[model samples]
Target: MKPSPTFEERWKRLTSRARMSIPDDFPELPPAFHTRVLAHWQAQPVESWEDLLATLGGRAVWAVVAVCAIAAGFVFTDFHEARISRPELEHVITLEAWIP
Candidate 1:
């Protein structure tokens, strides 16, 4: 049987294949490339129940919050809004549309 490669051997193979000379902070994609990629994704239609499910699953947090709020007998939006309004609450507020 062949001997297993050491970690250094595996890392050397990986780095050699992708020989990126740019600094880590350099952006790999251009701004126009991002726009084109976004347009491509938007143009592709969801074609199946599984696709629909996947799209819904990606937004599943709202469903989870709704279920929990229903079980607790409170309006889900109100509960979430109240949580956000609390002065002592420290949470990162993000744009939900971009939050996936």
Candidate 2:
């Protein structure tokens, strides 16, 4: 099996065989393509930061809503001063048993 020609070799052969005939009045590429490309790349981080801020802002609003809901639940609860019956302290906790 033969290996495929490298891009440089293929390009050379293709260009040599068929040269495109561009009109003399053909419009050239826009000036400073490099500068435009660089500017776009540099501006990406700022856009990303704005997106991050937007996403975090939405999450923060949800977080505040959840906290307010939880606070309301606690505030509406009937936390009575009910008497808690207890066993003798000696029977509840045995230091000698815990040490072993």
Candidate 3:
């Protein structure tokens, strides 16, 4: 079987190929490239705290609504329980005859 190349041999081959591939005359970038790039980067919209708050703000409202709905449900259950415990009090609380 053919032997695999060692790390040093592979590195030497890689470096030699890279050296040979170097451009004879590498073109220079446009003037003020860094300034333009920095300007563009800075101009981008905020993607951190403001974004998190905007996203979570709606979710927070939803969470509050869900919690309130669950609480209201539990309140009804408690009302039902209280009613079941003291059946005699229904006559005083309501004008209509108790059905159940």
Error of 2 at 5 (Å): 73
Task: Specify the highest-lDDT model's number.
Answer: 3
What's the lDDT for residue 65 in model 2?
100
Per-residue CA lDDT of candidate 2, range 1-100, in tens?
A: 9999999999999887676654458666686987898898887755567788997999999999999999888766736445444655555467556856
lDDT of 1 by residue, 12-48 (tens): 9999877886467865798999999899989996589
Where does candidate 3 stray beyond 4 Å? 1-46, 82-100
TM-score of 1: 0.24
Q: Write the per-residue lDDT of candidate 3 for residues 50-96, one digit (tens) a residue.
A: 88999899999999999999999999998777444456566656646
**Clash counts for the predictions, in order:** 0, 0, 0
Candidates, ranked, lDDT: 3, 2, 1
Deviation from truth (RMSD, Å), model 3: 13.8
TM-score for candidate 2, residues paired by index: 0.31
lDDT agreement with native, every candidate: 0.76, 0.77, 0.86
TM-score of each: 0.24, 0.31, 0.35
lDDT value, residue 19 of candidate 3:
98
